[model samples]
Target chain A: MIRSLAELKAQAKELGPRRCVVAAAADPVTLQALSSAQKEGIAKGVLCGPADKISQAASKAGVSLDGFEIKDCPDEEAAIVAVEEVRASGDFLLKGHLPTSSFLGAVLDKEKGLRTGRVLSHIAILEPASLGRLLLVSDGGMNIAPDLVTKLDIINNAIEVAHSLGIEKPKVALLAAVEAVNPKMAETLAWAQITQMAARKQIAGALVDGPLALDLAVSEEAVKIKGVKSDVAGKADVLIVHDIAVGNIFAKGLIYLGGAKACGIVAGAARPVVMLSRADDAETKLNSIALGAVASVV
Target chain B: MIRSLAELKAQAKELGPRRCVVAAAADPVTLQALSSAQKEGIAKGVLCGPADKISQAASKAGVSLDGFEIKDCPDEEAAIVAVEEVRASGDFLLKGHLPTSSFLGAVLDKEKGLRTGRVLSHIAILEPASLGRLLLVSDGGMNIAPDLVTKLDIINNAIEVAHSLGIEKPKVALLAAVEAVNPKMAETLAWAQITQMAARKQIAGALVDGPLALDLAVSEEAVKIKGVKSDVAGKADVLIVHDIAVGNIFAKGLIYLGGAKACGIVAGAARPVVMLSRADDAETKLNSIALGAVASVV
Candidate 1:
């Protein structure tokens, strides 16, 4: 199994030099990250945007695009062209230098989008400084307040990503404020329902448990202290939250406060979609590209 | 200002040996922590439980009750007796080994409780390993899903605690999944309303901003990258989450994964109420007592 980001990058390098098609790839940071990924043999870049803008971005970032393939397109048509290119032959898609709504608009386009009949969710893979293994937090960036069906899709997407990382059967923990199902807390009730469904094989390919507090979901000491009996307690591979706020804050807390290294990608699409944030560091962008390369292979 | 947990403990010791009344003070961990705090001159404990159980717990934990004042009472009456004692003479109240509901029942009792005409909220004071200063997170363990008015009270309560910790004009950040006030996300709308309310002096004693993501709330780098113009963007003294799930997960994530030192107490009562979890370490328990001692002074 890929235990850390280092191992993940190494695995991606071994399996790759996969084609990563970038939509509106005229951002200096994106050029720099893709250039580094290409140099490391993780992915080969197919930069899709206006040729002049791509060249300007590469020069500004001090990056060499000798081994890259450039596709010239107008600013408004960049996302559509990139999506069509990926659907025709390219491996995965990456967003760069564009509004999120515009880029997502192209991806969700009815006739020419990467639709898989499943709800699209964002998965963040984190290598917390305190934990030896990689942890996955789901739907933090994509789903605002996911309902029960959407949460199921989010879990499935996370499990798929874990499988690509070589985890045979990921343990999924549904996180809430407390372990027990409180009548007033609606999330707890939803989690309890999901847990029951998982037990009955309605959710397959993972050991799923629910209504766990953050501590019990990740800490063995907390599990023992609380006397919680669950397969996922203290050893969860994926944490599924009810809403975007919880997942986003939880994942970002680990990264900003815990010194965790993180990379994120959107799943449930026909192809892996790497969405880079301007605030993300260079290392995170490269790691995300590597994650996309690996997730695309399967 | 107290920048770290060590500094917090020192300040507590300097101002204290304040009287702390313990409800159901028969838990081994509680006895041990209180003994250490007493020795450190943080608090003078008044153990309010059956003398026999207290003695047994102290001996089991290798603690001495030499300087502690024992108030022998049945388990059922321990919380009420402790509340009454604190109302009469003690500086603060500590929950030792009782169910949280029972202990809070006494604190929230209409006639005999420590009512201050404000909604009670739990504030977790964290000394994150990555940050040099203390960060306060509110309503994580008390209010489940608070409305706009309750959130205002929660923010006010946190501001009071920040003041007690010597932070003048604390900067409060209302946390959300994103910085923009999207109409689709109800929490973001509420946060925007709260921000406006703070601007109008409806919520006083702090500089408050809303709809900030976790990174933008704490990281100057994120603020610089996003170009967010706000006083509380990068220097938030207090983080106000929308619900218990978000606050709980965020705080515990920092503690378990970020290696933060935390101690929590319920604010808005007449006296600070220290509520330590069983899973907390010895140092955390002691720090909580110290926090109670300091927060009780004002």
Candidate 2:
């Protein structure tokens, strides 16, 4: 139901301020976005990086970080220590100037990571022109070639995100090449299994079905015409893709070619994480921040 | 280059009159579309069905088929005979008032069917709002888990159709989840092989590259920023998909969600074949007939 960034901001305000910890927060764009979020009362930031670099970025970006906490960490290791600090202090995590591998390593660090024994996934919430509601596309940025069990985790992570968005019993579509189970297509096989699990009440609080094409999943008319019987077809809130590559392209297509508005996050962690791309516009970044803040509370 | 159906009609005029054989052509929509085409001198139809039924439908649709050829045949054998007649005399084939199974059975029959050894593939030519030129999406309606060879066939089929549309040396993007040649993703591996084949000149008359996500393939800015190099990156004319379901959904997404105009055909066969969907508009069906007529000549 969230239409624009302004609406998301209004929603976020009602949820109060969320505390966020930035790992290796030395990048100008990163600092700018975080500072903007903080100034807008969307989130309160705890910047973790080299103290001097963080201030320089803040100054260069023309963002005043007065009264905001800045935790000085020499490098990535310090970022990890700061991550631990913020996690214990009830603040969400964000990546900054650090390499993606290093940042993720710290988050997945067996002993000190934010893992709750669930497979981590990324979900992109897209507002396309052809639809009246938001669409949740999952695992496009994470979990490549996940097994059936891992897919369960991915679906659950996306469902949790949908639940946070106030969609009770979110409809989930397991995407495949065809709507029928085929021995050759592993995605279809997995989709069938997943649909069965949801039907048998193994996976609770979601109406699940597949293997649906993109059209059948989103268009109720297409569903009726195609004679696809399921609770999720034509009104899918979540589209659980077969692989990272499919999800990645599917979500990106909605944005670049389909003229859609999108915001993304790394889900299945203990806390909601904002993971906006650097090339994303100000609105997208802010929308994602708002989503992270609201989702964290939910 | 066609922004709408009106533009497509203008283009169809220059392509000359296409010979179309409509099987079981007793449907009012089909007759109306055919009459419109005839009035514009874009197509000449050979209607095959019960003669009385065809005349009644034509009259009801406010069409006079005085100049059109009506080949009398029973309802049960009309589809097969029409396909055979077209295969022998006409340039293209159109579907009307027949089950898909029956029509496809005749087209795929080894002895009398139109078979060229290559796997029959469906190509949806879309004109997206974000794109200046047409986008050819393939295997959405046919082919399931195409192995490396079948994928090559699909690519070849799409390339052939694009070539018939006057696109010499089309830029083909073999789509996947990512741009890298990841061994874990089977689609990427196939794309890498296909790319190599194109590089070695095994796949001729096209510039092929892959494992590109939809964004990188269509957005030159994304390709430049990501440092992904390929001739087909930003100007892909043909999109060789991984599977039928994905291709189908992708094409439909462009149409329903992105407001794209497209003409579909089953390519790599003995002759150009039109297979317009029931969901398609009159213009879409007419454009497909035009495409079939043009492809048949090549």
Q: Pick the candidate with the highest lDDT.
A: 1
Clashes of each: 1, 3
Listed in order, each prediction's TM-score against the native is 0.98, 0.93
Docking class of 2: medium
Model 1: lDDT equals 0.93
Compared with the true structure, what per-residue lDDT tens digits does model 2 show for residues B89-207? 88888888788889888888888888899988888888778577778888888887789999989999988887777788899998887788888888988898889888899998989
Give the residue spans of candidate 2 off by over 4 A: A1-5, A182-184, A227-229, B1-7, B52-64
Per-residue C-alpha lDDT of model 1 across residues A1-298, encoded as one tens digit per residue: 9999999899989996999999999989899999999999999999889999999999999998899999999989999999999999999999989999999999999899998888899999989885899999997898998888898899999999999999999999999989999999999999999999998999878999989999998999999999999999999999999999999998998898888999999999999999988788889999999999999987
TM-score of decoy 2: 0.93
B-chain TM-scores per prediction: 0.98, 0.94
Q: Candidate 1, residues B1-298: lDDT per residue as tens digits?
A: 7778898899999996999999999989888888999999999999999999999999999998899999999999999999999999999999999899999999989999999989999999998886889999987998999998899889999999999999989999999999999999999999999999888888878999999999999999989999999999989989999999999999999898888889988899999999888888989999999999999977
lDDT of 2 by residue, A187-295 (tens): 8888988888887999988899989888788888888778878888889889888777677766777688878888988887787777767668888888888888877
DockQ for all models, in order? 0.89, 0.57
Ten-residue segment with the worst summed lDDT in candidate 1 chain A? A250-259
